[model samples]
Target: MRSQQFLIFLLILKVNLKDVLLGFGNLKPGLKYSVLIFAVALPVMAYGSTLSDFSQYYPIWKPASDSTWNFILYESAIAIRMLATEFFYRGFLMWTLMEKMDERYANLIHSFVYMLMHIGKPPLEVPYSFIGGYVFAWVDLRSKSILPSFLIHFLGSLVFDLMIINQVFICL
Candidate 1:
């Protein structure tokens, strides 16, 4: 099981890197602005952190020493995982499925799977992902790339993580 996993891991990494390079090369100013404007809603993003806190899951452990190397490794793993998710859902799910079906229908199917993937987490997040998944899919379609979605997903989760850390830190 572990040996086969490496090949899949490498395949996914290659695909994501290819899309990222191409997506960055072809990126437009409008998408940049959309992300910038979207970022103004950090407080709204904190809602998920609130739910996490209520569920008593706040404050993922940090590096004991705040070492730069530790931070890089930790954040890089998260970024890679987040990018993999965006590529799978926004890139492959939207682009690949659109070939065999209507775009709207493809997005709907993608949304269903996206939400289903969120199962076993907090219940509130399940429905939220359904709605957010469609929006991310639509954005990927319009932007013609998964880069924006990756940025949004990555930074949005970062914000939530920071929110939880801040709350925990302040209390301590």
Candidate 2:
């Protein structure tokens, strides 16, 4: 669902996959900055699930059984979903906004829209989504690619799921 805009843009612009995934010329700054961005986000992700009752919202821990293959598949699906989300937000929306306006305004608009999309999420998450969205947009704009934000978002989601699984199922 989230990837529809990205797909439509790709069709209209006839943009290539590599350029869309990596962004245009001069990729070094984005690449260099990704390490710092991920490092800073690591600890936040470590404690993310503890911030709210995400399990009540997602109910994913019910399937955290000893089935390795099932767990792998679940995580894989999450990764794909997160990727699609990042592409939609940081890739399609951000870049399209940048084309029409200044980068800072684009980031703000993108962050607001991103936060709005989190309206049905855990209560605490809805407000914080704006901050996280802005930060992710900054990283995407700096790196000129959604890959960095995608990595952070995907790993953060994975960590949140793992933490919930560990607390609800494993630790029980």
User: When superposed on Cα atoms, how far off is each prediction in RMSD?
Assistant: 4.8, 3.4
lDDT of 2 by residue, 20-130 (tens): 444453456655666676677667656665665675655354464455566668788878788888877887788778879998999899999999999887877887789
Backbone N/Cα/C clashes per model: 0, 1
lDDT of prediction 2: 0.72
lDDT at position 130, candidate 2: 92
TM-score, structure 2 vs. true: 0.78
Give the 10-residue window scoring lowest on summed lDDT in candidate 1. Answer: 52-61
Kindly state the number of residue pairs that clash in model 1: 0
> What is model 1's C-alpha RMSD?
4.8
- Residue 125 accuracy (lDDT) in model 1: 70
Quote each prediction's TM-score: 0.72, 0.78
